[model samples]
Every structure is written in structure tokens, then in C-alpha cells.
Target chain A: MTGAPMPRLPTGIAWLDRLTHGGIPARRLTVLLGQAGAGKTLLSCQIAAARARVEGAGTVFAALEEPPADIIRNAAGFTWDLAALAGEHFHPLDLRPDPDMVFAGDFDLRGMLATLSAKARQTGAGLVVLDGLDTVLGWLASPARRSAELARIGRWLEEEGLTAIVTAKAERHGGPADALGPLEFAVSLVVALERREESGGTLRALRITKSRGSAHSSSAHPLFFSHNGLEPLMWPGGDAPPASQERVGSGMARLDALLGGGYLRGSTALLSGPPGTGKSTLAALFAASICAGGGRAVHVAFDEGPEQSIRNMRSVGIDLAAHRASGALRLIGLQPGRDGPEQLLSEILAAVETQDATALVVDPVSSLMRGGVADLGQSAVRRLVEEARARGMTAVLTSLVEIGEDPASGTLSAVSTIADAWIALGYAERGGERNRTLSIVKARGSAHSNQTREFVMSSEGCTLADVYTAGGAVLLGTARMEREAEERRLETLAALDHQRRLRALEAQLTEAELRQRRSALESEAARAELALLEAAEAERRAAQAERQARTAASRSADTPAEEGASA
Target chain B: MSAAAVALFVAGGAPRSAAALRNLTAAIAATGRPEGTFRVEVIDVLREPGRALEAGLLATPSLALTAPHGRRRWFVGEFDQPELLAGWLGDVLDGEPP
Candidate 1:
């Protein structure tokens, strides 16, 4: 309620404090207990590395488990020059319990503490971090001893007003018994780093397991391990929502007619379909149209890079590279969901502002879905669309829908909820060749042509021609419709010759059964069969007997009689 | 540390990065603590700047932990969490909430 009464909360990381409540409690020692690879070292190093200029209170990093070289390597990943912190104010105390002694029974943490305390006191350091507690605790003769040591360390740091943090491995730690263990105990603060599979990639997560002394920021920051170290993700919200901008057309005549007039500038349209549906080509053509209409467009690709996308679009007669060179189109190829949703959102916003983009396309929002993060991605993508809309830029997102997934999967459904318009694209065989069709399913507040438009990409570029009034029904979602059409064609052909399909089915079934029988027989022989099978008696002898004889005969009893009888 | 360098570094995911910010505030608060004129409440917003925004901060690297009751004032913008928090504490408990 009232302002925090502590002297001042010194956040180990300044940039983190910029996103946190204020800082960790100034008088209490917090424990950042997390899983391995949760970025504990990264977080601690940032604090340790910042001390050279932290002012008044010096900081010491007591790295006991990791050798100085490994520490340096890890710090380097965070882009920190730990060596530069020496003397000017930063100090790294290499208190590594001997690697050999780490497992020995005679490990004394109190002595290590004494040395650390002396070093901290001498430097007038206010912040101290035991690079982690697990390494040191494992040195303890017993879990009880380990627990006692942490409790003592916690009390000393809290009483001395030396803001401290002891990094610990996140496993089954202690309980509410004393001042030790994981989240169940009473620590001034607790931070957990967890690596979660997200969008098919690993997401670095920083969860505030607990923060006791004062009110704290209670959000889990989506984090990433980068060349520099553990970085917190920015918020998904755009810097400042862009005021509504002008109206803009998608530029594909048939596609535009389907969507009433054209897409609203800043509105979000979702394009969903399977491969060969021309998702990328459609996006490229829209981008080209925007460029031709006197506005800039940016394409941030995840499926393919700029070169491939440019080349492919050129095959369709849309020369994106030209537009790029002319300054009307800016294409940035991003690695597949290489970043979390928030990070991706920031990158888009940053790119848009830097390029003064009036329109943007993310070709295959499905790329955002591939990273192992299932639930968060949908929200993140939706937020991205919202951000694009807020920035007053038309956002056209392409999604890959497996024929089976179109009707049921929650991904596109979630995306559909956020889209201002829905367009379905697919390949349909008219003669003996496949042609692409772009159908607009919904467009809010606009009169969309109730027709599926023929879209083609040849040596020139994407072209929208005639609309098909009787393409069966537009919402068959591609695969089913194609399969049904193929069935009808086959039926017509079969009407002329009924026996062809029957013979085909019988032969196919016989071939399949024979294949299964042969495979099963071969595997059984490989497993234990030794005797050669006598075709006449094979049916009488069970499969088990056949296997044993086969396996045994293969090794011994040149037994040409057994083989001859089987033949 | 250069502000940009610190930012890029903290954004890297250093948990201790917050400790450094806290010590910064405490150190400056220590300079002013002897007088016991005002207390500072600091929140590390590195993982949750939404909290910073809730406090009405539009830009990060900006501080809002000040009050001044009505008499004095607080301004936000700095790379240091502690040192910056003090400038605001001087306003808090003395003026209207920021």
C-alpha cells in the first residue's frame, strides 16, 4: 500500500527492473532456484558483470561449480565482459569446491562462506551470489546439513542488509520445514528458470515462484537464451497504437471482388490452406499490389527466406525483388518461429516503424505455430495481428491447413476468431492439370463476391481471372472436394467398365495380405525359427515350432533332407 | 555501463541483473537513508513492465516511484533502478501520488 520501507531494492539486472515491480528487496537475500539451463547463470552473471558501475555497493559472483573458463564461456553468451569488471568494481570469487572434493565427505561450506564473507566485506560489496546452491549442497555430508547451511546463509545476508542471491538447481528441494528448499519455504524471494518447448523450439521462462518481503511483479517472463545470455521478452503490445490509416485493396481483382471491395488498410485477413495452395504467391501478389498502389509493404517470412520467396514469386510474375529495390517492398526472412510471440511482435513493430510500412504479410502464420509452444502461440499470433491492426497496417497472415486439420484443429479456429476476413485457397484439377483457386469465405462490413476465383501464377506473376459459380461448394476445404471430384470422375469411367475396379480391389487386397504374411513369416524366422518349412506340413506345425526349427537348422544339420522335403 | 550495453545485457536474461539494479537503488538510498526523510519502494520490471505501466509509466528506463503528496515532484528516466528510485522517493510521502 504505502511505498516500500526498505532502503532501496537493488535489482541485479537493470533492464529487468525496467520490466519488474521495482527491484528485489534491498535487505533480504533472494534465492533464484531454477532448472538447469533456466538461465540462472545468465541472470547472475548480468548482476555480477554490472557491478563495475553499480556504485556504492559492490557485487561479487562466487562461482563454485563452474570453472572460471566455463563461467567465462557462459558469461560471453550473455555478451558480458566479466574481465572488464575487475578492480573498477566487479569481483568474481572462484570458490569452486575442488571437483574431486565436491563429492568427498569432508566438504566445508562454512569455510567457503567465511572466505566469501571476507571477500565481500573487503570489497564493501552489498550484493553476493553463490553461483548456485546445488553444487555446494551436494558437497554437504547430509541433506540436513545442506538445509542448515542455506538457512544460515539466508539469515546472514538478510540481517547484514547485503542483498544476496543463491542460485540453486531446480529439483525436489526442501519443504516448509526450515528456511531452505524450493517454493514451499520462506525465502525473501524465489526465481525459477525453466526451459519450455514452445512453437517447436525451446522457450526460456522466468517464473517468480515466490517473492515474500514486498509486493512483486507476478508475471512469468517469456525468455530466450541468446548470444548475450538470458533475455526477457518485451510485451506484445505495440509501442503506441497507430491511428487508423487509409483504405487499401488486396490488388488481386478476382480475390478483391470476393472480399467485397478490398481489404481495409490495417485490417487483418487470414489465408488458410494446404501446400500448393499458393499461400506464399498470394501473399507476394498482395505485397506487389500494395507497392503498385503507392504504399510500402514488408514481408517477414518464416517458411522461406527472402531469396527463395522472391524467386518463387517471380515465377508467378511478381518480382518482389524489384519492388524491394524500388523501396516499395521490404522483405525480411525470419527463422521459423525463432523467437517467442512477444519477441516476434516486437520485431514486426520495429521493422514496420523503421520501414514506414503501410502493409505487412507474415507468410504462413503456421510458422509461428511450429515451435513447441502450442497454446501460447495462438494468443501470441492473435496479439501480433492485433498489433498490426493497431499500427494501422493491413496484416495478411497465411496459415497451412492439412486437409484433415481444416475442420477440427483449434489453431486455425483460434486464428479465425481474430481475423477480419477469411480466405481459403486450394488446388483443384479441372482437366488433367491442377489449378489454384482463391475463395473468400467472410469479410466483415463488405460485400464479398460469392464465388471462387481462378488464380494463376505463370512466368509473369499472380493473375486473378474468372470466378467459378459452380465449383461444387466453396467450403469443402480442399482435400474432401478434390477427393469427391476424383470419385465422380472414376465413377463415370467405371460406368463403362465395372469389372476393372473389382479386379483392382481383389488384386490389391490379395497383394496386401500376401505382403503381411510374408513379413510376419520372415520376422518369425529371424527371431527364432531354424527348421526349413515343409509346405505340406507347415500348416499343421504351429508358428512357434516352425521358428525354432528354422533358427536351429540355419546353424547346424546341413539337413538337405529337411529342406528338400519343404521344397 | 553504457545504457545501451546494460540494456542489451539485461535483456539477455541475467537474473542477477535485478540484484545489480537493487543495489544501485539501495546504494543511493543509503546515501539518503541516514536522514530517514523518505523510503523508496522499488520493483524490478524487467520481467513484467506491465507493472511499470500500471504505475502509469509509458516508457521503460523511466521511474514512477514518487509521490511528493502535492508539494514536490518526481520525474522518470534513467538506467539505474535504485538511484532513479530515490529521486522519486523524495517526492513520495511528500506529494500526491504519481
Candidate 2:
């Protein structure tokens, strides 16, 4: 009766706890919600039995929908000892079929709540479970009466120091507005259980629809229920060792330098830039780089075929087939319509694990989400990237940014936060000449050149020229670049001519200063001699006066008061 | 040939119950493969009245797979492929192939 607030324990379910802060914040009517088959009664019963098992409370579960015996049988399937727990300390009251004395006509909200409270007080129970809200809501004839009943029940449940779970069957086929019943506003927590038929089995998605005073799990989490009860399916999101393998160079030396010895063994990078900027080419080359480095790499082509990818990379001289033939690179060309987000993930995971790949290239993840993969939103790509990070494999992601916009200002719209680095390849036009500019927008854990460098791709190879710095700013185009070349030539010639001019000026200034100082010294020396003569006379006179003043002072001190007056 | 398929190939004489369909030697000798030319799934309206209505079947012998495709008319008279007709199905299915 007198301990700290029961630790408000996390019912071991993170999402549920997030909704009610800590396990329903004891002594409150925590209504369980859902449509008819929302597993509302199951949720409440689980809480009741869990409370008894965990906190050793005298728990009571009253079933209104089923016969008490049938309810007990169902609970037995879950192997929860409702009667046993009741035998030790708890008591389960089953009010089914109603009493002969009280007719349906006399039943009302006030009467029902009075009976509920009386039962709670009699049992000294802290948790109360109500099976269905419709029977109770029927007591109210109108909307105003319904709201009043809800408000009264909510307030009474709070005052009784009882955390009651009242479930109402919501209308789900309608919109969310219509799906939410009365308790959506009255209850402290609302967990909407969504179970739809998946391919093989049912997929259960638990969403915390509302929580009055807590941080609920907002994401619709995959749920699992077995004989042991309910739980949320946790993705690979816990603590794991960071990928420590050395990165294989992307075959572009300067690019490698910008990438801090290239991408780490298991890291996902997003290649975002305008179309025709070689995002796919760069991605293929990175994959080829991984195979060249002696580890397996899989190139999942969601948009382009192997031939297109290879031909595109050929511009930069990255031969994918040579590496593929060497038993290093595996290219899985995915027909855009075949798989979904989850399916692609499963396939990718299977391929990487089977291939034991050190790197993976998902060409243009934007296309994969926009058109290729079903069942994945923009956020789903983030989850995939997160999964890749957990596996410690390098995943190279590429995105096509629209042209004519400053890529420097553009963010990787598809899952950029988890990107350890972004290698932005863009095109800039200046003086009617279009040029290719490659810049490392952001590279985590590495120092990179800030200047937008010009890169030329040809049959020879992909190469990055000297960094382009132009006209009081960093330029990435050809016009200012040409102007800079001409200006450099002019500056070189001007520097040589200035050297000659400086030498001639130094000779003239040196001779002029020496001759001028000699003439001034002669004129100033005579004036110095005259000034010294006057100064010598003044010094002798001042010394004599100082000697006299000292003597007068000493004689005055010797005379004291009367002697000083006589002096 | 196995006794089951051999029995299925013979002619039948009378009406039979579905529970006895598993004992092919006696069931097929009495009643040939289901007589429903359109659909061939048996219905025992007496015992499984619920299931019969659910599956939309009549209270008699039924043949489920029946129809025409291209130039070939697949006269699927039996519940399974026939032993004598196996030769027409090709080398893949040898005499009511196992």
C-alpha cells in the first residue's frame, strides 16, 4: 500500500509502454480499443494475469461476453492461471446472462458503474476489466447522455484508484474518424490492433492510436502472439559491433581520397545527383570495386539491365563482366514489377548471406521505392538501409537528382540521414559550356575537398582534375576555368617584370638615402657642438644651486622648530 | 497395374455412397467414375448437407474437370488419369504414372 509508484513497469512491450508511459500508470481506467476482433478482451486479460504474476496483486477478471466457464477455458489455452492466481489472492467474478431481479428496462450507466465500483471496493482490487462497452453505452439513449456516461465513468474510474480496462468494438470499415468509438476520447490509452491476411499467414500491426499522458510507440510495429502471450516483433535495431573491415577503393583514386580510404566494409552510401550525371555508373563501379578487392558483391539492378549498367560503366572503364567472370561480382537484375519492399529485402538478405558479399549496390533506391518495390514507403528504404548497416556490409545507393538545381543545396530525398557519406555527381553550365563537376557533399568521419572539382570521363578512365577555384569563389564550370588559365599566364609574366622593377627601385632608394643622411649629419654636428657648450654651462650652474638647496634643507632640519625660526 | 486403377477402369452397375469411394475395387465395380459431365465432386446430401450446399454440389456422382481446350477434348472421366489412357498422355506419365 505504501511503496513507490510500482515502477510503472513496461509490461515488457515497448509500444504499449510508450503509450501509457509506464504500464497504464496504475489506478486508472486504461481502456483497450479495437474493432470487434481487435483482441480487446485478450489484451485486458493479459494485463490482469500479468499484473498478478508480476506484482503479486489480488487480480480479478470479469467476463461479460462469454460464460465464466468458457472464458476460463479460453484463458487456459493461454495457460494463464486465472483461477489459481485467484485461489491464492485474486477473485474472478463472472456476471453472465444477468440477474432475474434486475430487468433490462431498469439497467442504466449510473447503476452499472455503481455495481462496478462496489465490486472493486469489495475485492480491494486495483485493476478492473470490462469486456464490452456497447452494453454499457446502451444505457445512454442520446449523444449527450453517451458523453456524460463516458465522462462520468472516466472520472469515477480515476477516483476509485482503479486502472480499469474497458473495451469497445469500434467500426473499422469506416474512416479513422468513424472507426474511433466513444473511449477514443475518454480512455487513457488506445491500441488499435490491425491483423490482415498476408501471403502465408496473418500480419498483425499494433498501432498506439492515442495515449493521454505518455510517449506511445507511434510506428505500426509487427506483433507476435503465442501461448506465452503477446509481444512486438523487434527488427535488428540493438547494439552490434561496427563494421571494421577495410574499404575497397572505388577504382577512382582521387574519389577514394575524398572518401576516407573509400566506403567502409559495411556502410550504405547514397549516390544522388541530377539525371545523366552517372549515378548508376558510379554505383556499378563501386560494386565492381568491391569485387576487385577480393570480396563478393551483388549488384541489384532495379532500373537498368546488366548490359546497360556495364555499357554505362564502360565510359569510366569499369568492366563488370570481367569481375563477374572472375567469380567475384554477382549481378541480380530485378524486374521492377516482380518483388515488394519486404520481398526485395528478403532476397537481398538471402543473396548477401549466401554470396557472403562484402558490398551491395541497390541502383537508384528512388526508383525501387517509387515504382519497383511494393509495400514500402519512403521510410521503408530507411529501414532497409538500417538493416544493411546492422549486417556490416557496404551498400552503395544511388539517386537521380533533377538538373538545373543546385545539388549542393539538394538533400538525398530517400533516406539520407543514415548515409555515412554522399558522393554527389552533378553538371554545371557556364559560358554556354556544360561541364561535369564532382563534389563530396558530406563524408562522415573524413576530411574532404570543399571545392567542386571538374572530372572528365572517357574511354581511357574516370579522372578528377585539379580542384577548380575561380573568381573569388569556387567554380565548377569551364568558362571561369579558361579565364583562370589565361589569368594565371598573365600573372606569371607580370611577376617576372615586377622582380626587375623591384631590383632597379632598390638600387635608387639605397644610394639616395646614404647621400642625404651624410649631408644632414654634417649640418646637424655643428648645431650639436653649440648645444653641448650651452648645456655644459647650464649643468655647472644647476649643480651649484642644488648643493646650496641641500645645505639649506639640512640646516633647516637641524634647527628643528625654534632653531629653524632663528635660521 | 495396381488393383485400384484396374478396378477404376472397369464398368459400374449401381448407385454408391461417397464414404465407400476410397475402396475402389468394390465402388468402381458398382458405379463407374463420377457421372457428372460438367463437374466431378461427389455430394452426400444426407450426411454432409452443409458442405454440399457450401460447395454447390448435387446429390449424385460428380465429375469436376470437364471442358474443351483447343483441338484436344480432354475427356477427364475419372478423378485421376486412366491407366489405358496413359499412352496418349506421353512418356512422362507411364500407364497411370505413379
Candidate 3:
């Protein structure tokens, strides 16, 4: 060991490289321990092929258990062309023991080492893979001998300045030589592959049990075997996509209004509801919205195939088929039972990459939980959302909640907790009909409506209408329609009654005006009559006074007239 | 006369290779085979590593025996037990010969 740090050789697998903190230490012995059929051989071959293909570094692959031809054939199944890399940059040595060969007294691995060294020299190999080392160790009768051989191999690898990968079978039930046996102490790095039978399917995980002089992830990472090769699924812990302030439409204007300007770009939105509650329809609408805006979108349908999803969405006026035909949308249908969460995520991510999608919709993401590994599914969904956000893609994920199950609880809540917006869809059963209802349970950093709108889907499109509340109960379906009609009727009757009362008040005012006019006229006539009577009386009095004055005294008449005038 | 070919693969003059070669010679002498009946070839893997790889040698001091009928048998390790080596050679040489 030197004071200088060991240089790293990347395995060409992104997540694996990240897990090992830059891949295995170069020119050091690394051991792979796994049970039978646990992909030890495949992984080692991939590492060798990657070294040859990526760095163009020469590599030697020693097949101790299988023939070189079989290794080559199996390598062809992957995307790498191992057969073409043979003889120049890549050298394969068949060291499988002959069945007829017998051990005489004592032997070492000198012949095998010599052959390897020769091949390494020929190709200038920088890496060597001793696949199925357990088979070679099995030939030895004693554990001490096996340990010695392993140490010898390790020293030889170090002296040759070659990175080496040795694979061995992991024993079960804590046997004396369980798995690593004495080889664990001989290598600088140890990677263990595991296969567990889950209710959904077989789950494969890779864990780095030991790494000397390097910081690495200690937890087991789910493995996905795609056409390319094995990939470790991990939530990237790198520079996250900057928080986007942009908002994108959810296709339905009213729904957008409820969400306070639609969904935030590069954010995750959870649409949770029971079956037939239009969760898929809403997700499709989101996808269609992105596509209609000339943005590429990916819709992963877990419950149905692409054609079925297209047809079903078409019935709800969410023309997904049109978007798909226009190359703006890609539909990926996955069966939960067929693959684990890792494979599903890989496929979905692959689709996103190929389509260069900016928006993604996973209909009923809760279906991933059916794999019987809740933790795995949850982590996978988290990774999916994180990856989507890292690319600044708006992700609309649908989760299926049991009919009476609370959307805020259960396994689906794990998804909702990470989502920026959570829209809970349910059935508001009233009047013998179950009407779909949607409520924005949460919309972070936005002023969203708290009302639960009645979600209606028709041949035209999906729409959100205000839910009618009568008394204390929320009305929906035909009950809401009937209530609206009754309110309209009551309004009309009230209007008519008001009009009648106004007309009667107007008549009363008119009559009162006419009566006041008649009274004034009568008063004026009475006054005039009184004045005429008075004048007549005055004339009569004047006549009588004149007769009396003519008889008594003209002077008294004059005085009376003067007194009257003074009064 | 039977023509049986035997090849010895060793890692150049190592102590194990010398012991294996000496034991093999003594074992053949004990088999009492005619001199022309066997053709022996000694290949030092350290000197000619390609020959060792071409022979699919997995250990030093390995003995590869081929009969006239092309039937082959391989033995690995130094033949420190001369009797065991002699018996194995006798079985191969006593087989159907050309």
C-alpha cells in the first residue's frame, strides 16, 4: 500500500459507479459473492466488457466453471458485442478443469497464473476476471489450501497491476465456509448479489459488503436487468433541478383553477382515488395538455395497455390517441406482476429519455405496491419522482386507493408525501348514484381552492362543477340537478310576488294623490261659499242698517261705518 | 510397438517441476515400457506461456497423455507418490495400442 490514493476504474454503470464512489479501486482484488443464478457471472463479464468497451483497455476473462464459448454466447444476449472484442482488447481463457483430470500429490495455480500472465502480456490487459472462482477452489481438499491459493491469486493480480474480480458462491444457513469463505479476507472489495422471492416477482439486489479505503453506499440497491445489462436503481443525490416557478395547465380549466394556476413545472402531483373515479382520465388529461401545447409527454399505464388507454381516454374526450399519433405523447403499459419496481422504473425512465418528455403521467402508481414489497415500491416511486424533477419534468402520478380507504393514509400516502400537489378523487354517493368528486387536498406554494368540485366526464371532455350543498349534506348527480331546478323555481316565484306587491303599492299611491286633490278642492269651495254667505249677510246687514239709519240717524250709520272700518 | 505421447507442462525449473519430472521418469521406468513405445515432451510454461495456454493447463507440473486412438487424460500436481504415478501410466499404456 502506498500513501497515494488508489485510482478508480468505472464499471460504466452510472448508479453502480456512484455507489462505489467512483467504481472499484483499480488494480485491486474485488470479490463477488452470490448464490447460484444470482448474476455473478453476468456481472463479472459486464465489468470486463465495460473495461474493454469504455476505456478500450485490454481485459482477460478466465472462465473456470464454464467454457469460454458459453461465456461468449451469454455475453451476446446483452448490448455489448463480446465476441467482436475477442483477441485484441479482450482475451478469454478457458480454465475449466477437465473432468478426467486427477490430482496426484500437490499443486498450485502456477499453470493458470502463467496462462493468465501470458494472455495479459499479449493483450496488455488492465483488468482480469476469474469467474466462478469457487469452482476452482472446490478442487482443493482443504480450506487452508484454498485460502493460500486465493492469497496467491491476489498477490499475482497486484504484481501484474491488474484489477481483478473473483466470483464465488454464497453458502446458505451459516455453513463453515458460507459464501465468502476465506476469500473475503483476500480482497479489497466485496460485492454481494442477492435474489429474493417476493409476492410480485423475484427481486434482485446488489450490496457492497466491504470496500477498503473508499466511501460507498452500505444499503442494498435494487438491480434491474435490462437488454443493456444490470443497473442499480438509486435516487440520484446530485444537484437537484432548480425549483421551477413555471406553471403548466392540467388540461381542464376548472381543475386548473382549483389548483391555483395548474401544476408547477418540474413538480410531482399525486392524483389518488378508487377505481373508476376518473384518476386515469385526469392523468390522461394532464398528458394531453402537455402534448397539445407542443411538449412531449409520457403516460405510463399500469392498469391497461397503450391501445386500451388511448381508447378509454378517447371516450372521456381526452384525445390521447391524437397526441400519440402526433408524436407528442408516448404510452407505456407495464404489468406489475411481470417485473419488480426497479424494472418498471427503468422502462419508464427509458421512455422518458427516448421521447425527451417534459411531462409524465403514471396512472395508478400504487400498482407498484402489488409487488408485495411496499418499501421497494415506495423507494422506486420516490426515485421516479426525483428523477423526473431532476430533469425539470412535471410528473402527474395516479394512485389507486381502496373505495373507503383514506387517501392520506395507506401505502399511497408515501407517494403523496413527496408530491407538490395532491388531488384526491372520490365518489360522492347521493340519490342512488355515485358521482365523481375531486378535491385539492394540498397544493404547496399556491393558493388552491379547498372546495371539492364534482368531477364530470362526458363525450366533450372532463369538467369540474361546483358541488351543491343542501342543508348540511353535499348534493351530487341527479340530486344536485334537482336541487338546482328547485332553487330556480323558487327564484322565479319570488320575483313574480315582488312584482305584484310593487304594482299594488303604486295603485295605493295614485289613489292617495287623487283623494288629497279632492279634499283641497272641497276645502277651497267651502272657503269660497263661506265668503259668499258672509258677503250676502253683510249686504243684508247693510240694508237693515240703512233702513234703521234712515229712520233713526244718518249720523249713527256713518259712525257705525267708521267704527267698522276702524275695526 | 505402441506410440503413446505424453507431455509435461511445468513453470520452468521450479522445485515442484523438477520433483514432478523426476517422479514421472522413475514412474515410467517402473512401468517397464519399451523406449520407443512412448514419446515424451516437456514444456516449460514460463519459457513458452502460449503452449501452456494452448494446452489449457490449469496447474504447474501437469501431465497430459494421449493414446494412438486420440483418447487423452490429464493429471495435475507433482507426482511425489511414484507408485500412484506408475499405476496411472500403466493403465493408459496398457489400453488398446496401435
RMSD of 1: 33.3
RMSD of each: 33.3, 22.8, 8.6
Off by over 4 Å in 3: A1-4, A72-90, A173-181, A198-200, A215-218, A233-248, A253-266, A334-357, A390-393, A427-436, A444-458, A463-567, B1-3, B96-98
Looking at candidate 1, what is the lDDT of residue B93?
Answer: 41
TM-score of each: 0.50, 0.43, 0.77
Query: How accurate locally, in lDDT, is each candidate?
Result: 0.62, 0.58, 0.81
Candidate 3 clashes between residue pairs 3 or more apart in a chain or in different chains: A171-A179
- Pairing residues by index, what is the TM-score of model 3? 0.77
For residue A81, what is the lDDT in candidate 2? 70
The window of 10 residues in a row where model 3 chain B has the poorest summed lDDT is: B89-98
Comparing 1 with 3 on TM-score, the higher-scoring candidate is 3
Better of 1 and 2 by lDDT: 1
- What is the per-residue lDDT of model 2 for residues A1-567, given as tens digits with 9 covering 90 to 100? 334443353343434554455676565555555666556676666766776777766554656556656655566756467656664545555543232111111112433444455556666777767676555455334565566666766777667666666666656531132222355566666666766655533455667676666545556776545444554444423343565556667767888887778876666788887777767777876787777778788888876677777777776788998988887888877764455454455566567766777788888676555532234434446655655676677788887777665544433544566577787788777667777788887776667766677777777877677754556655655665676788899999999999999999999999999999998998899899999999999998888767666777877865434423433
- Top-TM-score structure, candidate number: 3
Per-residue CA lDDT of model 1 for A241-290, tens digit only, reads: 54343457786775665666678767898988888888877788789999
Candidate 3, A85-153: lDDT as tens digits: 888666888888888787987887878888888888878887888888777677676778888887888
